[model samples]
Target chain A: MPVFGFYKLYLSSDRKYVKKLKNLLGFIPGNLSLYRMAFRHKSIATNVKKGVKNSNERLEFLGDAVLGSVVAEVLFKLYPYKDEGFLTELRSKIVSRVNLNALARKMGFEQLIEYDNRMVSNTRQGSLLGDAFEALIGAVYLDKGYEFTKDFLINHIIKSHIDIHKLEQTETNFKSKLIEWCQRHGKDVSFDLVENQEGESNKLFSVHAIIDGEVMGLGKEFSKKNAEKLSAEKACEALGI
Target chain B: MPVFGFYKLYLSSDRKYVKKLKNLLGFIPGNLSLYRMAFRHKSIATNVKKGVKNSNERLEFLGDAVLGSVVAEVLFKLYPYKDEGFLTELRSKIVSRVNLNALARKMGFEQLIEYDNRMVSNTRQGSLLGDAFEALIGAVYLDKGYEFTKDFLINHIIKSHIDIHKLEQTETNFKSKLIEWCQRHGKDVSFDLVENQEGESNKLFSVHAIIDGEVMGLGKEFSKKNAEKLSAEKACEALGI
Candidate 1:
């Protein structure tokens, strides 16, 4: 296809293009400009003068929160008996990078992204897919409203991807359970730092659990508390306390 | 006060208690059980043999997500330009342990707790405070609905506690900007593992970013990707490309 022909066929905001996109999204009468901006990648440089922002970064920001709120509200209504910790874990899992990327790919967003030659060759598909998915949400919200966005999310995202039964069964209070066990058995549990190695990328903390003056278990984590918990769990298992 | 006198003073479901709680919460009653369940701690061994579940954990779960969604919606409306990372960080700070505990304490929940002698003396204060705060939210939701909860959260939580201006000034996108800079300058940038340590608490990864085969920067984190981003950021600063 000719370069101009590609623009005519793919980038036109005519009835055909709008109709096709509407059919794909399962919604109609959306703002075409917003949808256009949603699909526009940063690599496709705008011809505007300096100081004019070109990318959909701003829209992505709005979209991310919209997505989060919609998903949270749905989960809240669906699982009245589930706790805050479980709801948070479920939300995180649903909105994770891998899940977003999978959704973007499923929607065939690559065909819509307007990237230049250089960016097209890059292997960083993960970031692109994530960005596109967020942008699409922004578009949906702008075209409709909160109610429409909520409906779309419920129908397209939650109902399609998440397993409600599995989410209900996920364990959350391991740390609390461990503490309760220690209290019941009259065992003194303490976590001590074994090492702190600072490197170029991130800080690492190593911790060991001391039970009865013996190093019963060890763990490593990005945060000190997480490491301590891991070590404490190991110690609990080892001592059978 | 005598034990019988104290029981008479404290245990009566007087109009004063109802009026005082209603005034404090700014919510009218219909779902009194939901409110009651919100305040009832699991430690208080209620008559479960008759099938009355004694704890507010389930309510806490519902309230937590409701609080999060409401807060998120308020932030989204207030901060139009803020990104996902910024919003997440701000939400975390707002709903942090210290903040929630302070809120609970301010509401005079410490005196309202009905824990037994054993659990009361223990350091379960943190959990108690957190649960009470969540219960208060559950009460508000039941007394009102989603609209009331949203308004209450905005007025009581966000406006009272969070510093919106400070959050607006925080910067992000360092990693993506660095990549764009490298590509523009026709330089190859790659992150290599410089150190790997496994300790008792968590696994740590240190990474170094090499630009055009020269070590430009180093970074460390619990996760390799995060550490690699830090290394890339350092390289961006060192090279000034």
Candidate 2:
């Protein structure tokens, strides 16, 4: 009863967070502290008690899992015939850091985050918005439960941002595709690193894709892998095999 | 009405599977077909329509995510004081391929799996059992929903096998620990590969841990990382810092 009383008092005290959450989630939170904690980044974490972390890290972890599960479920249903690999790739596309950062910006998630770190003001630096986005899911799961979290994601996020058709058309790795095509056609393919030069903080690499002892495509990029991919894409188009 | 009629007819046809599931899951499945799909491994998968894969792989992916979310929630509540890294490490230990394989055997999960692959008979050959274990969790989530799935995992699995204290004592990586300890004590430590010899199909790597420019400990293993870990353990014991 005492705990319940405290929770009630806590909920009543935070009308601002409650209003924000209601606008974002379209539901009143059962426990307000969980949502507040979700917004609280580790940079501003105070009162470091012994072994406990008084920040959003744990919640972010939990939210990441929850978000994955919900997305997997939706994808499982949406693409009933798609193989595991396709499902996985699509899920990754949906939850990719770049996509999440853009989604967070579109949803005004940065405005709600409680971070004291100066580095995070840049917005595009690492997984700031994405982490907060996931932490928000965790808070929703804690406040309302799994079904509600799934519903919140579906109604609020997935229907708006995730375009399944567009993602399928988007090329992920041309090198892998080219290799698979070669294997299926019984053709030998190899990628040779043609050049490597020092860049600002990385190495600029040039690669050439050789198909059946012929240099079919050439590419230059910051990483050897990317260069190979670009070369493979060119090779895939030029060879048309 | 037609779909409901077909569902009832389908449920009636699989009395044996239903009975077996009740014995295993402690509840009658709302949808037995999902559980049936959970056991359907890719090797024996039939009716491979265009984009559809009639195997447990997709279910396995979904189940893995669901299982992780539930486990994360449990760990979060159980270890209220533990940090995110600690929680992630413990979760990895619990859901690791080896541990999952062992748990699957303990729960007789392999007995029900439908795999036509010759390699799976080895039991410890790879992640076969663990994959099935995850697929089973996915089936449970689909059939009984998240709440029931969580209860099943907590009541049937975690309560029986997952000992938090024992896990905390489990040495994950001696090398990482030694490096951390060295850093804390302001001492320089490095692990170098001292030798490489040909073994069955791989090279046996010998590594030595050098502390303050002195060879403190030596180790040999199949992998450089493992060899480093072994050497680090020895160095930790020898230095006793």
- Global lDDT of each candidate: 0.66, 0.78
User: Is model 1 an incorrect, acceptable, medium or high docking prediction?
Assistant: incorrect
Best by TM-score: 2
| Position A65, candidate 1: lDDT | 66
- Per-residue CA lDDT of model 2 for B1-241, tens digit only, reads 5678446746655767777777866788766667878888777778669856678898998999899999899998888888889888888878876578778877777667887777344423346677888998999998789999999999888888677678877966768867887787688988887643211124777788987777777777888888888898788657642
DockQ score for candidate 2: 0.32
Which window of ten consecutive residues has the lowest lDDT sum in model 1 chain B? B195-204
Error of 1 at A36 (Å): 4.1
Top candidate when judged by lDDT against the true structure? 2
Chain A TM-score by candidate, in order? 0.64, 0.68
Candidate 2 lDDT (Cα, whole model)? 0.78
